[model samples]
Target: MPYVVTRSCCADASCVLACPVNCIHPAPGEPGFGTAEMLYVDPRTCVDCGACTTACPVDALKPHTKLGEGELPFLELNAGYYRRNPHADRTPMYVVPRRRSVPEGELSVAVVGAGPAGMFAADELLRHPGVSVTVHDRLPTPYGLARAGVAPDHQDTKQVTRLFGAIESQPGFRYRLGVEVGTDLTHADLLAEHHAVLYAVGAATDRRLGIEGEDLRGSVSATDFVGWYNGHPDRAHDDHPLDTERAVVIGNGNVALDVARILTADPGTLARTDISDRALAALRAGRVREVVLLGRRGPAQAAFTVPELLALSALKDVDVLVEGWPDGLDPDTSEKTRLLADLAARTPAGGRRRIVLRFLTSPVRLTGDTSVRALEITPTELYEDEDGTVRARPTGGDTQTLETGLVLRSVGYRARPVPGLPFDEASATVPHEHGRVGPGVYVAGWIKRGPTGFIGTNKTCAQETVASLLDDFAAGRLTGPARVVRTRTQALDLDAWRAIDRAERAAGEAQGRPRVKFTDAESLLGAARAARTART
Candidate 1:
């Protein structure tokens, strides 16, 4: 049976390494690898060695025969991408070279943020002998978005945590959780104690709609909504009033699809998922029946990934409808555009819940007195510039008002400035050239390049930053660790995290779920302490 990539694929691309025939589309170094929504196994070329199944961090690879009814759609979903070009050129499987160890003396690096970037950096740094890595994150949780931002229903994507766990289990690797670098310890402290410090803190804030009435009670960002559902301690208690019968989401990105899916999904269906208990309860009590995802551009410019759109379309009782198709559609298309056209061609089944995908519309204002009551949108025109770039221009001829109680802006994400780091206001990123911010200081991931690309994108990003740091060390630009006293911070290490992980899994076991997460610092830290005591 051919193996298929499923909804939970984190896009980490580990499966590509195990594929002997390079059957997976968009493997690293390939043309579209960076932007691909998910790596696809070419069924036509798949040897069914089951190598990818073992290599996948999220266990996203599954044989056709063993897939559940809900998962069977992915088999076709994977195949459909290749249907257009079945005989696409294939290359030898790319092999990541083993990193050579640092020469001269002992190397100790501090990586801030335990997200994909930081974890991958640590893994790369550890490949060198006589090197040790210490990771730090402000939150009690180890992984950032991988733990708190991924949709709970995507259990497979969440499995990338296992890869991180493996990295953490490596010798000379440690993490300090619940410790804010700038607040708890100065940047100089880390610089003093380590040869270098790599900042991998990802883009944390969402781009705002910046429209009138945006501050209305029901106006929320997709970032918070994702965080809330994934049991992010900071947003778990948010009062996301899902009291609206119909909601308007501004943007056509994957995040917008995620929000629409969460809003319209049956709460009973979410119960078995790893969604937060409070979020589950709120969703169950919610009356939301319809969601309209608005895109300021045409279907050709829609920002959502094809896989996400496929998942949205596959929703059992939810209708996926599209509006605003241009009379003469452009012949030029991408995989995303082709899938969107297919969705537009299909008729809705008149399901109880609906997700309407509207194109060439931009939300001009949020209309309401107390809470969001409606969204005023202006129609847009798409034009190609001399450079062949498609741009959206607002047209005044038509305006529409959507009676939506809730409005979610899912435009994009911005990296917040770290207190002690040099930042570029224009890009909302740390000032860096090839990941090196300064001597003995570097950056990786979204904070370094602004939020773009998939999770595996960070691995390449981290590799670049590490290469720079290693070059600096080899050049003797970084002399040595400063001779300064380091203050002790009450932080949790990998063991503490494992303890908390076990406790959460134990708690989830009784609930018949994957894991019941601790959504607060107190409970999470307390569990860690208890685990530490037990270990002693």
Candidate 2:
């Protein structure tokens, strides 16, 4: 009856930190833990305390008896991580790295957007012992993308926020959720109050394919799709566009794999994870099977991490196909290459869910009338430069058509500028060095740097930002914003957060489930406000 790892797990390894007996594998900070799909509960060692369940934001963990029928496969997936080595104790939860310290009254700072970058920056800054931090966000819930943007099956990744939650409850840090700085308050106001403001707003939108049939009913940006399924208040109420039999994803990155895995996963399997009820219902009725993922370059040039490729290829019933490996490169048996080759080798001998990995091919057009009915593509050629970088160009008169109903654009994410700050549209980042963008302005996260790197990469980045901020504090450079603090929320708050958490758990209990999330913001905020009044 051990709960299994479903398709949506992003290996953040939070459960490893929460588990009392340390039953979870690839613990946080472990080598492979960062890339793992989800944390697994060791059935033999699990005392079934359910501590991990409460700690999970996406609700990926469950008691063995609590797993729904479709999630039964995960039990095996969780157990499989230990197959090769019985004593592989990687992924241990490590200590927070050395924290930066500053003078008492000089330690005040304002950080916009409660996403991973903001949270990590705050976590690093709190090490100063006396610094007080005010974290601002547009949504009622904290832990920005960690709670809203990550895929639903990545419950363990979401669990990292339990650490954030613990941080939220910390004495010096103040989370002002549902407050947008530019709107509710201004940069001037924050500067008046604190020494500096760090904008960690993240890359909130998707890069368009900019081709035909992009706005069609079936086509969806994996960004929007992931947001909708993971209960982003903005998209939670909107109808999902993923009603199709065949899906074409135009990138080979991790996000593309997430969409492909979700599209090909068993609806029953998804129901067990924290996938939105609306998405689950749509999936139950949708026609998606084969998702053809297109890559503009060859395997070596791929932007996706080696592990994500393996995770996508390793699904039970789904088969992954790689069209071309680099011409002269001898394939190594490294886990990623081996898994990728296995994916290529397992493609149905010719038929499966058909995650066709096409290299050096660019989308010429998406052919369809009312909605997408097919796609037009042109074959591309690649040449290596003296720098060893491969470049791709289309071959003339080599156009082909692939009949499909859905197209997903999974190019990289572009970080957005904080509304009031100076933005370099080309870079989408607030210009900064060592965290100081201006006299009282600074930035962090995807907005500070374009969307790149893994979660751990942010720590060093955040540390660097804090170091610069501290240096400015020592120099008496950063000033406070213009306005005074006005504490009024436009929407959700902590009491409301409690109510939302309660409602989700209550729903899970009513249906003999673990915990079910509220898909829309209205319900969450409404419940949150009600809870606030009740507490008062």
* lDDT of candidate 2 at residue 469, scale 0 to 100: 79
Candidate 2, poorest ten consecutive residues by summed lDDT = 4-13
Which residue pairs does candidate 1 place in steric collision? Answer: 8-157
Per-residue accuracy of model 1 over 291-363 as CA lDDT, tens digit each: 9988888887888776677777777888888898866885346666666777788777774899999998888
Question: Of the candidates shown, which would achieve the greatest lDDT relative to the real structure?
Answer: 1
Q: lDDT for every model?
A: 0.84, 0.71
Sequence-dependent TM-score of model 1: 0.93
Supply candidate 1's per-residue lDDT for 151. Answer: 86
Deviation of model 2 at 138, angstroms: 0.9
Clash count of each predicted structure:
1, 24
